[model samples]
Target: MLDLVSRPAPWHQPIWQQLTAQQDFAHAYLFSGQPGGGKRRFASAFAAFLMCDAPEHGFACDQCRSCHLRLAGSHPDLLLLEPEEEGKAIRVDAVRQLVDFISQTAQQGGRKVVVLQPAEAMNVNAANALLKSLEEPSAQTYLLLISDQPSRLLPTVRSRCRVQPLGLPAGTEALAWLTEQGGERSREECALLLQMAGGAPLLALTLAQQDALAQREKVVEGIKALLKGQVAPSRLAEQWNAVPIELLLDWFCAWTLDLLKLQQGAVEHATSADMEKVLGYMAQKLEVQRLLAWQDWLLEHRRLFASKANLNRVLFLEKALVQWKNLLQRR
Candidate 1:
């Protein structure tokens, strides 16, 4: 049981406190935010509040039986549902299991809480299944759905619950919070991560400290190698393929956009401190028209990343990388 750190965004104190304060309210809630933005943390804190016999400052007293049970994941009344596999949709079966559990009534004789992390991962059938439960919720049973991609959810589903949208705080605040956690990171790195995380510091730290950042850095290095004509274009594309398919296309676009800026001498909009060398190398080596054309590739890549676009991702990168190298050589 990963205890809610409640940092990066202290939504727990501001939002969850109010939600928990409601003595009589609807059972359904939707926590929408960037991944690691503390939506799930808020939900867990709220869940602990709901089950705790003694709640202090909207937090559960660990001394209470309810808190102990919740910590053990045996809180009979609280069910935390999430996808077992990464990047996989939550199937109807998981929702069905929740339905079945909810139907059994409260076990600890308190409020029944159902938490769905990344609620948007529910496929149509699963969403429908959960919708049925929401349509006619049982007594004392509450539903908390947390998702970063709320717009992808069915309007009906979105409408049925109260939506809590969380965004990232200022970099200074996030850094303060992270420093308190004993983690050391530079402001420039934090700035790059914050923007890359789409304003979510929790997400920034998670992705930055995780393998994703390392992979993206490597991919950027590969791109640099391609520009220098020191690496095979196909090898870099292979590395991109080896990275997470879902996130690769996104960061790839970002990298290209940076390249686009550099080639045009938009150095002020540079992303990293090391951008000077990369930008100078690119500006000296690539034509203006070529950089502009790569932006078009990036636009298409962005589209594929946002859509059901498939395998062409790697092919797209391979083609564009070759074009980038060609254009650089033509210099």
Candidate 2:
């Protein structure tokens, strides 16, 4: 049981209306989207609606018993299946438990809902274990599989669910929503945050709240220092170890792409103006092909990091930084 409010964001209205207009639902739904696109939030709200004693206009009646239970985080029929820890795989044991949960009767005498977040986090064994349930789901049981990377799931598993792709909001809608949520950022700052987040409003709001711009500046400065031979890769890796590796790699990837774009005279489309000097310097020093290769490497490493591969973070960063430094030494 998790305390989840069933308020859908503004962008969710159309999808909600479409989904709720249905009299019957597929046993499993695969909500696929970029990170922070609100798939999980929509799934939660839908689950609440399914369990509500009285649903009104496609939403859960907040005053009902099931809704109260849901709000109190005591919903007897709602099961949330996620990784035990961030970046860890959802193990077979968890799927076994989910199977058992599905076998039992719904305590509320209504629908039973299971929300599996980042469905790609399920290990191979766990995914295989969950497949049987999906193929032959029990009556009145709804499984919501929310994934940022649906391609990582097995073909068999993917084939079983009704895939719903969620897209980012329009730029103006995203910026307006972010401004309302973040409260303190200027329009320019909000726009930058939205750009950094690839136009995902929730992610932009999170970055604004976390002062991610300052952190990004530090990373850019480190790269500048690295290029100038002012710091060693090992030292830079040590300094950056406290930051999330995924975020660091993402920023590095963006910077690498920006450098390539600058080299191609596409500066207008570049995402980081604060790093204009660094990008220009790198664009001049590194060949476009080399920058593209580095961008590919960054993307590969980002996937590895997201999959929670057992790589030594400091050593990995050191290797990347050393490669970056060596690029400057090339003709």
Tell me, by lDDT, which candidate is best.
2
Best by TM-score: 2
> Which consecutive 10 residues in model 2 have the weakest lDDT in total?
1-10
Flag regions of model 1 displaced more than 4 Å.
1-8, 211-217, 237-248, 259-267, 280-320, 326-331
Q: Which pairs clash inside model 1?
A: none
Writing each residue's lDDT as its tens digit, candidate 1 over 200-299 gives 6677777766756567677768867887778887777777776765565566556567766776667655564444477656666777776777778667
lDDT of 2 by residue, 1-331 (tens): 2338575677978988998889899999999888877777788888888888998877889999989888888888999999888878999999999999999999889999999988999999999999999988999999999999999999999999999988889888888888887366788888878878888887777777777877776787898888888999999999986677767887778778787777888765456777777767767777767777877887888888876788899999999999877766676
How many steric overlaps does candidate 2 have?
Answer: 0
Q: Give the whole-model CA lDDT for all candidates, comma-separated.
A: 0.72, 0.84
TM-score of 1: 0.81
